[model samples]
Target chain A: QTAATPAPAETWLPTLQVDTPQQGFDLAIVMARRAVKTTQPDVAVLKAQRPHYAGDAARLIDVSGVAAAWFATIAAANGYWRD
Target chain B: QTAATPAPAETWLPTLQVDTPQQGFDLAIVMARRAVKTTQPDVAVLKAQRPHYAGDAARLIDVSGVAAAWFATIAAANGYWRD
Candidate 1:
């Protein structure tokens, strides 16, 4: 039986739930209700934030890019990256 | 004094640390060591899990897309989304 291992990094991130079974992609469940309720949201600013409100939308496109690099190194060590 | 507000969504996602000032984009800091140390990483499987590491990298592209739609709605209610 699989040992009761420590919670994964994703588990630590309560907001972002990685639902591989359902959507297959990681799900980032944000708490907008709390944020809107207390801090007060700015429609104009938030709206203006746009698809890539933070900056270059492309930057966020590849969540696994940085991670893939590390994954490759791991593959090489364990002899997985080879074709 | 400012109110001691509850932690934001990002705060909950300990894995993905958002560094706005540093890179101007949200930083998704995953724990590779823990993932690697345990379960024994499969270089092939992990490497094959490249680009998207799931399916289409494009899906992960717009982290703010889904969030933006909701953000704008709030803007309308509180008058933040309007141009």
Candidate 2:
């Protein structure tokens, strides 16, 4: 009898269950939040940084552009705007 | 006085508010979800596509990689992994 194959090693981050494009995007956000939480556990520091960004229009635009690109990919995956 | 310049035409999409790196990332996720919902509002169609991706390892990896890149940007913005 052939030997049974061993299960693959676990990934550092397991694939999140997503039933729709919305879920997929939500998972991505969760992952990003987790990354930040893991790296910077201090709430005070996070709060301190908040005001600095409130009026930082340039950074705001940059971040939004990043989001737009990321969303574009998710939209494509869901076949949105497809001819 | 010079006539007040008309307010710049609104962008097609407005920037979301974010107080921290985590919030910024969360906003990205929200935008992505919105894009999908706006373009494809039918829940049934989204459900039908789920099975196709359940075992789509390649696509899963691709999506995760995209998330990783996105999270990395957020991390950098928050000074994570910085020397």
Candidate 3:
């Protein structure tokens, strides 16, 4: 028998069911948290990182800016502010 | 002059204007890329990280799952798949 062709990478990506902007934001937060967990895996290391962050107001602002941008975009997609 | 009170942290976050799901997704991608850029900063370090990722299929799958979830949520928020 001939070798089977490999599936495209996109085909392997699962389609998640989401019905609302709130759900989208929730999923986004989950993904963001998972990413952080994966990257740092150690709570003690995360705690150590916090002290560096405490001194970096600019980084905090940058993070807040990104969060606000994400929130506004999600709001626009919902067509209104969603509870 | 009297001492000033500190403003709430949320007040410093900028509100980005986005009018569509496409805009939301685009901004998300920008934010994701920027996060990566900020974290690594050095191109050579990023390149080094690539080899480790290359051998990690599970991580790749996790990343794709997050992307698919985000896309489905965005589609739902838009009320349909959007171009």
Candidate 4:
């Protein structure tokens, strides 16, 4: 019987450095959930197009823009911007 | 003095129905943050491309895939999947 060789670790396309792996994974789940819901593309289409969309999205995250967006979102959630 | 007319409200494209706006916003912040880091594109280029990235990412959220990703993340966190 041939033993299966383990595959090399995947370098997640998004180059995030979260406090922990769990934190990053959690964020991915939340983001993925929202993304799927937002687009609501056909299941078959989504399966076919996931790589392209994920790749494009990863390439879009600007440091300043993401910082601004995240800050705005968090601030808004905390009612910092509204008052 | 001329008064400025308020613009129409934006209908968030992703069509998510979160329990609270904060939940959605928080998720958005997490996703955007991770995405921004993952790609690590030039700051100037990122600014020019934010809309496209966010839009494309939203479109990529697959129901089964996202659910699986999220579930796996949660399960891993709870040590359910590992021996």
Q: Which candidate is the best by TM-score?
A: 3
User: In model 3, what lDDT does residue B13 have?
Assistant: 16
lDDT of 2 at B63: 38
lDDT of 4: 0.41
Going through the candidates in order, the fraction of native interface contacts each one reproduces equals 0.04, 0.00, 0.00, 0.07
Q: In model 4, which runs have C-alpha deviations exceeding 4 angstroms? A: A1-21, A53-83, B1-83
Question: In terms of docking quality, how is candidate 2 classified?
Answer: incorrect
B1-83 per-residue lDDT for model 1 (tens digits): 33687555344323332322111111211222233324656777656644342223243333223333333232233222112
Query: How does the DockQ of candidate 3 come out?
Result: 0.04
TM-score of each: 0.19, 0.32, 0.35, 0.26
Query: Worst ten-residue run, lDDT, model 4 chain B?
Result: B74-83
lDDT of 2 by residue, B1-83 (tens): 34687776546445443344445455444554455567998989867865453233332323333445554454444443222
Query: If both were scored by lDDT, which would come out higher, candidate 3 or candidate 4?
Result: 3
Write model 4 residue lDDT over B15-66, tens digit each, in one string: 3433333344334444544555568747787577644533453433322233
Going through the candidates in order, what is chain B's TM-score? 0.27, 0.47, 0.44, 0.29
Q: Per-residue CA lDDT of candidate 3, range B1-83, in tens? A: 33596655443215344445445444444454455767888989877886354334333334433433454455555453333
For every prediction, compared with the true complex, DockQ reads 0.04, 0.02, 0.04, 0.05
